[model samples]
Target: MASWQQIEDDNPTFAAKVRSLFDAGTNKTIATLRRDGSPRISGTELKFEAGEITFGSMSGSMKLLDIRRDPRVAIHSPTLEPPADHPEQWPGDAKLAGTAIEMPRPEGDPHEGAGYFRVDVSEVSVTYVGNPADHLVIESWDARHGYRRRTRK
Candidate 1:
């Protein structure tokens, strides 16, 4: 897995675009695996700081318990529908998948009881509609593959 900083260093432009998508909204979606291996989706707020992506769950939250038991996770940036008159104006959507690393909370911190996890990104991707014929464009980065681009009609 690669850290967010590594992706940024390797592909600055693509990383910037993905970051912008995350910044465009305050709430994102996170997926986690339950004990029985069922999928669970939860609303979350993402923080990109100190070259890392992090999020915290409220004390004793199910999502917190889920992450503690299974770190594998996927987070999707907030989705925004294109304007009726300007479909091409959509900023795009982004996703990140990785294992979450629990971060230690400082003593007496305001949210010390909450659970925090730092993302160790295995994959990152963004999709958008291109100009002209509006071909679908997909750009992705992975620790093993580095970077890739694809387009479809």
Candidate 2:
């Protein structure tokens, strides 16, 4: 089987799924680990482009601080169902697991440390929604499919 990056590269539709959630959406609930080995959760608007995901953060944000101590994290994307008039049913839920890295931010970019965390996905899954293979369900207008940016040719 091909790798996630390879599959996403070969299929525009799959790539669109990852992009739709990162863009347009106001927040992504990111789960990370605290120093005490407890779970920590936070939400942030993220930017996904060029096969990379990025988000802003402050110097002392718990999420940022947690990432500093431990990089592994789980991310959840709230699936948006389309309206009834549409032809396809939107996905009910989805998730991705990966590592987070702090990118150096330029000076004066709001919070410190570039105010962003980048996640490199190692695994992705969709559950509770009808099998995605049925393109008809996804194509429906009533189903609120996750948002996607216009792809460049």
Candidate 3:
């Protein structure tokens, strides 16, 4: 797992693109595991701040309860459809799989009773249409394999 700062330090350009995609959308999606190990997808507000990818859930929320029990999680930035006329120009979407460790409440938090967590990223990635609209491209990074790319026609 890597910290947000480590990712930025390793590849500034890649990090910038990831951050831009996340900023392009308002509500991202988070997947949490239920007690039975089932997956639950929830709409969430996410941010890249204080050198971490972070989010919070309101007190007594299912997500908060889920995180407390199991920290593993995956987050996907909101998506945007590519323009049919210029499909290759789509900026793509950002995603990460990580463990969300609970953090102490920050001073002056508006969501006073919310649970805050900072993700320790296991993998980070993005997907977009290749130029010429020939195929889909995935760019990814992980602890085991620093960076890699794959394409599908």
Candidate 4:
């Protein structure tokens, strides 16, 4: 697992691309594990702050309960439909998988009672069609595998 800053320090270019995709829109999706081990998908907003990826849930929210019970989560970046006339111009989508750890409340936080957490990232990936739009490309980094690139027709 790695901190957001560690990933950026290790691979600035890849981090920047992933950040662009994430910043393309608001309201990303997060997947958490339920008590039954099923996946629960919920809307969320995350921020890159203090060298970490952080998010919060309203007090007593189910998402917070889920994380308190089990911190594993996956976050998907906001996405847009590809341009009908120019598929080659489509921006990629990004994903992050990690463990979310509860953090001490930050001073002067507006959501006074909300639960805040930071991710210890295990994997990150971005997928898109490459230049010329010939094939799909996936750039990925993982704690175990380091970094890799793959393409598909």
Candidate 5:
């Protein structure tokens, strides 16, 4: 796994595109694993600051409990469709998969009693339809393999 800062340092361009997708909206979708190993999706607000990607949940929330029990998570960037007249203008979709590291909430944090987690990214990817040729373009990054790009019809 890699820290958000490390990803930024190693792959600035890819990181910027991913960041743009994440910043395009306020809320993102997060998937967690329940005790029964079932998948649970939840709405969340993520913050990129201090060289870290962080989020918090209300105390005793199911998502909070889920993370405490199993830190694995996958987050999807908000979806934004292109204007009807300009289908090629879309910014594309991004996904981040990683393990969450629980951190102690700061003393003055409003959600001090809640749960806070910083992501240790295992994978980051973005997919979009390329213009002109209209082929699917996929870019991915990982701690083990670094960055890669692929295209499909």
Candidate 6:
């Protein structure tokens, strides 16, 4: 896996995809490495800020314990809309591969009971649902004009 810095630097387009996914209100399912090196998967909120994604827990749950033991995590977000032009290639699934670390609770965070998880993505990829094409393209969006093609597989 590339270092977090390297992934962002080498894959700006991929990063943008991650950002778009967050903006679309996608719920990211996080897989954290357990203490015994087992995998623990849990749903996480996807919060988009500036140019990155941030996640926080609402219950300070067991998932937080798993995070403290291991930082590696994989996140998945199912597509909200099917790809218009390439139905086969983008039947619509998106995945984020990365390392996650718990961010310290802010002094006055409103969600004080909520735990925080921050991922430094290594790779962002997509796949279609039961299609001959093997990959999906991602688009970038903002308030002004909405989504535009950001990258191809």
Whole-model lDDT values for every prediction: 0.91, 0.59, 0.91, 0.91, 0.92, 0.61
Model 1 is weakest, by summed lDDT over 10 consecutive residues, at 128-137
Across residues 48-95, which tens digit of lDDT does each residue of candidate 5 receive?
998899998899889999999999999999999866776557779999
Q: Candidate 5 at 71: error in angstroms?
A: 0.3
* Per-residue lDDT of model 6, residues 19-128, tens digit only: 56545655667787777887888887776554455677665577777766676677777447666666674435567666666777888777756677666665565544
True-structure lDDT of candidate 5: 0.92
Q: In model 3, which regions exceed 4 Å deviation? A: 110-112
Q: Estimate each model's TM-score.
A: 0.95, 0.67, 0.95, 0.94, 0.95, 0.63
lDDT of 6 at 25: 58
Report the C-alpha lDDT of model 1 over 59-133, residue by residue, as the tens digit: 989899999999999999999997667766788899999999998885677975798789999999999877753
lDDT of 3 by residue, 98-146 (tens): 9999999989877777899899999999999999899999998898998
Error of 5 at 147 (Å): 0.9
lDDT of 6 at 101: 61
Candidate 6 regions exceeding 4 Å error are 1-14, 79-86, 89-91, 129-153
Candidate 6, residue 95: the lDDT equals 71
What's the CA RMSD of model 1 in angstroms? 1.2
Model 2, TM vs. native: 0.67
Q: Write the per-residue lDDT of candidate 2 for residues 23-139, one digit (tens) a residue.
A: 536777888899999998888666665567666666678877888889888877754665456423554345677778777775666654534667666665443333333432221
Model 4 misplacement above 4 A: 110-112
For residue 105, what is the lDDT in candidate 1?
Answer: 82
Local lDDT at 124 for model 1: 96
**RMSD (CA, angstroms), candidate 6:** 7.5
